[model samples]
Target: MSLWYFLIDWFAGVPTFGVLFKRFMINFAWVCIALFVMLVFQLPAEYAAIVYFGFIVVNGVMGFVFLRQRMQMRD
Candidate 1:
């Protein structure tokens, strides 16, 4: 990668992963809120498990996507 590419957060003149990170963070925050709500409301164990698994799945997907993008950019 060029110095400019290393110092900047764009790819081919377009904004890079900041947007994707922001979106993922927002969704993560919502998942956290939902988990907190479930706890506060004493929701069923099954419901809590579902939400927790959903969070795990989302995290896994986001990590995969980020790594894929990074690999693509490296080339």
Candidate 2:
């Protein structure tokens, strides 16, 4: 496998920290995508801010759901 994939898989398998690490990476990806869209479309400052806020809220909800599912699966 590629080095990047190997590293990601290794980190993801780590006991407790792995979950947090994966969540952080997912959130970071969302932020990066939002920034890319804003820059590429040349959105106004107000619109960009709103888009960023929406992405954050969506990420939070997704993370919560993911964690909840993980907990349910563990039971």
Candidate 3:
């Protein structure tokens, strides 16, 4: 299997903290992408705030949906 898939499986299999770890990693990746975009575009402070807020909202919603799906699959 690919290393990426293996890492994901490893993270998911962690005792007690797998879900939290996955969510954190997802958020961290989104932050990195957002920062890269902001740096490349050199957004103004106002727009940067908007972008950051949007990314946070998106990340939270995506995380929620992911958890919900996982829960459904477990039942």
Candidate 4:
């Protein structure tokens, strides 16, 4: 409904605002987690960003592995 929300929905091709809201929540959670770790551990905040970015890639691999393992178990 709002301008920025409209732009995001249009750009993402999502028909409902709920979908956009869900995606934003997930992304924001990851960012919060990264920043929290950085602050609590006294590590460089940049590495937190780097690690969060890496989460995208490693998540795919882990998902694939879990899927494959489940498929194999069914046989």
Candidate 5:
């Protein structure tokens, strides 16, 4: 299914909390794996922090988009 549809459905309570949490953990697992590899390779601390910061920014944008979509649907 489309990304927008998936997010909208999740926000609308179509999926149970367990399912959503599981999905989040699964996706986050990959991010953790990538970070681990970067650490193992001895990447510079400043670069590593930038990667983490990017993740935080993306997460904030996703939250904003989800909230905006939900609000639009309400109107």
Candidate 6:
């Protein structure tokens, strides 16, 4: 998807963005989905999105920690 490309481009050293925006963009799909349901499906999407984003953050943190340990072990 285009959003994924944007994230990769930003990760590959776009000068304008830093880690915070990168993380937010990584999770942007959920925000967009939440918006769509509110507009189209007539559902309460916000609370579910908050939970989804929380899960995403937790997964990202765990992945980062796992990768860091792997690199340290390799060294």
The model with the greatest lDDT is 1
TM-score of 5: 0.63
Error of 5 at 52 (Å): 0.7
For model 3, residues 1-75, the per-residue Cα lDDT tens digits are 899997566444433346655766776787778877888998777876876787677556655656676787689
Name the best candidate (by TM-score): 5
Candidates ranked, most accurate by TM-score first: 5, 1, 2, 3, 6, 4
Writing each residue's lDDT as its tens digit, candidate 5 over 10-54 gives 445423445545545654676688789999998888877877776
Q: What is the Cα-based lDDT of residue 18 in candidate 5?
A: 58
Descending-lDDT candidate ranking: 1, 2, 3, 5, 4, 6
Deviating ranges (above 4 Å) for candidate 2:
1-37, 40-42
Model 4: ten consecutive residues of lowest lDDT: 7-16
Number of clashes in model 4?
0
- Name every residue pair that clashes in candidate 3: none
Task: Spell out the clash pairs found in candidate 1.
Answer: none
- Candidate 1 residues 1-75, lDDT tens each? 888875243223223567666756776798889988988999898997888788778666766666777778789
Q: Relative to the unseen true structure, what is the C-alpha lDDT of residue 15 in candidate 4, on a scale of 0 to 100? A: 38
Write the residue-wise lDDT of candidate 4 on 1-75 in tens digits: 799996444344433446545655666687788778788989986787687776665445444554565567679
Quote each prediction's TM-score.
Answer: 0.57, 0.47, 0.47, 0.40, 0.63, 0.41
Give the lowest summed-lDDT range of ten residues in model 1: 6-15
- lDDT per residue (tens digit) for residues 1-75 in model 6: 699896455334323225545555756666667666766866676766676777577546645655565567679
Off by over 4 Å in 4: 1-13, 45-75
Instruction: State the displacement of the C-alpha of residue 39, model 2, in Å, after optimal TM-score superposition.
Output: 3.9
Candidate 5 least-lDDT 10 residues: 10-19
Pairwise lDDT winner, candidates 1 and 2: 1
Q: lDDT score, residue 62, model 1?
A: 64
**TM-score, model 4 to reference:** 0.40
Clashing pairs in 4: none
Q: After superposition, how far is residue 72 of candidate 3 from its true place, in Å?
A: 0.5
Model 1 stretches astray by more than 4 angstroms: 1-28
For model 2, which pairs clash? Answer: none
